[model samples]
Target: MEKMKLKLLYADLQSDIRVIEKELETALDSSSHYLKDASLHLLKAGGKRIRPVFVLLGAKFGQYNIDDMKNVAVPLELIHMASLVHDDVIDDAELRRGRPTVKSQWNNRVAMYAGDFIFARALEYMTNIQNEKAHQILSKTMVEIVQGEIIQIEDKMHLNQSIRDYFRRIKRKTALLISSSCQLGAVAAGADDSVAHHLKKFGYYVGMSFQIIDDVLDLTATDKQLGKPAGSDLLQGNITLPVLLAKNDSAIRPYIEKALSGDMKEDERQVFLKKMRSSNAINEAYHISNLYLQKALKEIEELPANSVKKSLKDIALYMGKRKF
Candidate 1:
């Protein structure tokens, strides 16, 4: 099913996501016309807004107020979008979400300035709440997230790294932001400490599973589905879970190793994709993701049995089962 149709299952949070979308547009606007246009270029390129959805759902467990929560919710998404613009520059990425990436559409210098501008705008928006705890959590998450990307660059082409290394990288790169989203939402709504804690844990588990599935789809899904080439990670020399698992195979390891050892032509890239898909690697990776999904569902079960919680549970389940 389409991501939107799937999200409609969580009807309770629909109004909140809509609020966040509008808030995001307002948040990205700037006094400087250049900054406003640049930020809006990335802003108008929509995403699933899953982070804000988690933020809103977590708020439901407390004295939920959309006005109170939008301050946190809008900034969180802008921070994420800012990172994406910078990441495309770092990766030399040409496209994002099936459209020309900011770095590709403009020069790297413009992209960098745009990202910095948006990040500052996000912090400016966030400052309205005056919550030191929220700032600490989000600031630290942003730092660690950047550190994770640096380490990912370090780990590239080193095929023999342990599974623990991959786990460590993804936890910082992907899971922490989602975790913070839930915590910030709870904090904004003045949810009890225990409820905030549980929601944070739930976001972490779901984020991990969600990212693992994304990595898997990088090797398995079509360019149309993924908005990029299949095996793009492999071609980029970023060893993901499926590649790491496939490397453990005596028969399959050498092909992937050989593929990684040098520059990949289009024909070679296609062969690498085929082998990775046919290997037990993808299956094993799915198994690992399912474990995290189960843990995520367990966290959801601990929340009050409200319809919002139930819908969050369904989204977690859907992450494990998504094919594209």
Candidate 2:
């Protein structure tokens, strides 16, 4: 339902979305049967295509051309898709969107190769733009994304890290790519730098709020809503905002500590999740997500006031209020 709200909010771009969607279908023309299958499996598993939507929205600030914007929008989404395949391997995740992840459907090696192929295809599409800044920003973002994942592995099961640590991680791991999506779209369409800058900041704030809400929903939403077990992040030892806030309670720290120590059994997972959900930690995390949304709204206000701006504002609000 929350996702549907976004689709309705941005319905004006349905035409642009159709073009990007078709581009995604043909983005990877791979020879390897397994590679094609794995890529198709992930692609067929529907997503909101929020990154491409932002790309289209950003392009609205300038000479809107679906043809040119598809270059940026498609490649941005491909880069994101490639990251997800690799992420399932890192987290040993089995499901995404209620379907088996590429790593689970095939194998780690195949998933890796598929990810590489998708990334290379993204670069191939990106090179057509001939914008050095876009290329530089995306390449740097790609490097930072891997670095963020590396740090996630380094900090896994170590619950003592600060909130700033988590912020830095998400900025690289998630926000940067979305930020680039907006900037690349605007720049590609010949929007002025000032407008591009505002949209980039807008994407960053929206991305931050979105990820925080994602972390909160992991603890609060049901398996049916999440399409995976609730509290999967904690189970996988990913220390998210809810876990961090819950740790402030002396009583809850030991459970998290035990979970991090590998003493948490499969059956114990539900008990810990229940406690965290019943606590004030959820509220605290929500407050933070709302804070990010407020910042995102300010960024949107700076953008040219129009239907596109309204849609971007709607997206930020959805992040705060989404059930999953």
- Cα RMSDs of all predictions? 1.6, 1.3
Worst 10 residues of 2 by lDDT: 261-270
lDDT of 1 at 60: 82
The digit string of per-residue lDDT tens for model 2 on 209-244 reads 889988999888889988898877876889998898
Which candidate number maximizes TM-score? Answer: 2
TM-score of each: 0.95, 0.96
Clashes within 3 Å, all models in order = 0, 0
**In model 1, what are the clashing residue pairs, if there are any?**
none
Off by over 4 Å in 2: none
Say which candidate scores most in lDDT: 2
Error of 2 at 88 (Å): 1.1
Per residue, candidate 1 scores C-alpha lDDT tens digits across 1-324 of 467666776776777788788888887777877677777777677777878887788888877888877878888888889999899998899998798888887789988998998898789888887778888988999999999999999999898898999999999889999999988888877888887898899889988998999999999998898888888787677889998888877766766766676665777777777877888889999999999999988888787666687878887887678888
